[model samples]
Target: MSLLGATALVAVALDQWVKWLCTEHLTEGRPVKVLGGLIYLSLLRNSGAAFSFGSAHTWIFPVVTLIVIGWIAWMATRLRSIPWAVSLGLVLGGAFGNLGDRLFRSPGPFQGHVVDMISLFEPYGQHFAVFNIADSCLTVGVALAVLLELTGRQRDGSKAVKKAT
Candidate 1:
């Protein structure tokens, strides 16, 4: 899982750097178009998961994030395939990206909010949920992992038995 470790570190660095830029340059709740009206950087402080779900349970996210981090670390020891490594790296990085906020950002530790700034879907009048690079990485990584699974590729570099048609 050396590849996974390296990829995860890189992902975390990139995610955190992007978030830092958003925190330093973008104003919260203020939308600034970057690539026309379709894409904008709209800063937000999320105390919950996607779409601001479970905002009331801010403390729980940090705990869950920690669990996820630990789980990824455990998985790293056995990771083999590139797809698996990349996928896990993205998940791990995204988890830590937000975890960093939960552990260090404003309000209080383990109750801090995630920093989101990227937004899309302006052609429809209403933008999609505010998100960040970490979220993007997580979505892509998960999709890739699912694709790998469906294609009979196992995380440990083995192929699954093909079922009779």
Candidate 2:
């Protein structure tokens, strides 16, 4: 539980810190090269999911995020493996980070836009979706969770026994 809480807190702190930096220094719609064009910092405000899908139904995101947060909390109560704890922590932190934006950012509560700044390969997300640290955490956490499941690693720190076919 300690590991999970600490990881979540750290992820949220780092995510929010970077978002604050981006909001303070980056200009909207302008791309700043970060790694010789491999990556660029371009500010964008997205009210919907990846690629700005379902932007018209922005309220749904916060509701879904809250449910996810609750589910993660429930899972944490039974978590025993360090890897699972970290994975869930990252997911929870990412959800909370984005939820904060939805609840407190501009354009009113539950309709606020997420601040995205990182663009890959091309400017203004021509090559990829513009995302933030929270998105990165969510993606990595989900990937790790999938890998763990595929390997038969259980949340109780035990390996699943292969059954005879």
Candidate 3:
């Protein structure tokens, strides 16, 4: 539990710090190569769902983000016996990071765009939206969680735990 907690805290802090750097330094739509083009730092503010979808819907994005975060928090409390506590924790942390930005960063409550900096993909073509560390954690965490759920393996590689014990 401590390990998961510590990792979650680290993820949140790292995500926030990088986002701050992005907003402070990078220009919107400009890319700064980090590894000869394999990776770059590009500033982007996404007001919508992942990959910048539903951007025009405005009000809906924040509401859904809030709902998702709320559900994640509730699930966290009920997550005992699941072996993927750390992964779940990461997901929660990442969700909170982006949610925090949406709630308090520029623009307004539930209206602020998430600061994205880390960009990794091929150039000379359409690329994935620029995203931050928190996004990475959320992606990996969700993928892992879903995989576990589908395979019936918890974080410990055991079956879903029985909490009634």
| 1-165: candidate 2 lDDT, tens digit per residue | 889888889889999999999999989877899778999999899999999999999999999999999999999999999999999999988998899999999898999999999989987888778999999999988999999999999999999999999
Model 3 over residues 55-161: C-alpha lDDT tens digits?
77656766766687677666655555444776777787787788888888778887778887776764211477667888888898889788878767754445855
Better of 2 and 3 by TM-score: 2
User: What TM-score number comes out for model 3?
Assistant: 0.80
Candidate rank order under lDDT: 2, 1, 3
True-vs-predicted CA distance for residue 87, candidate 3, Å: 2.0
lDDT string for model 1 (1-165, tens) is: 877778778888998999888788877656788666778888788998888999999999989878888988888787778889999888888888888998899888988999888778552126478888888888887898899989999878999998799
> Top model by lDDT, which number?
2
TM-score of 1: 0.92
Q: Pick by TM-score: which candidate is best?
A: 2
Cα displacement (Å) at residue 49, model 1: 0.9
Model 1 segments beyond 4 Å from truth?
123-125
Candidate 1 positional error at 32, Å: 1.1
lDDT of 1 at 99: 89
lDDT at residue 125 of model 3 (Cα atoms): 19
CA displacement after TM-score superposition, residue 27 of candidate 1 (Å):
1.6
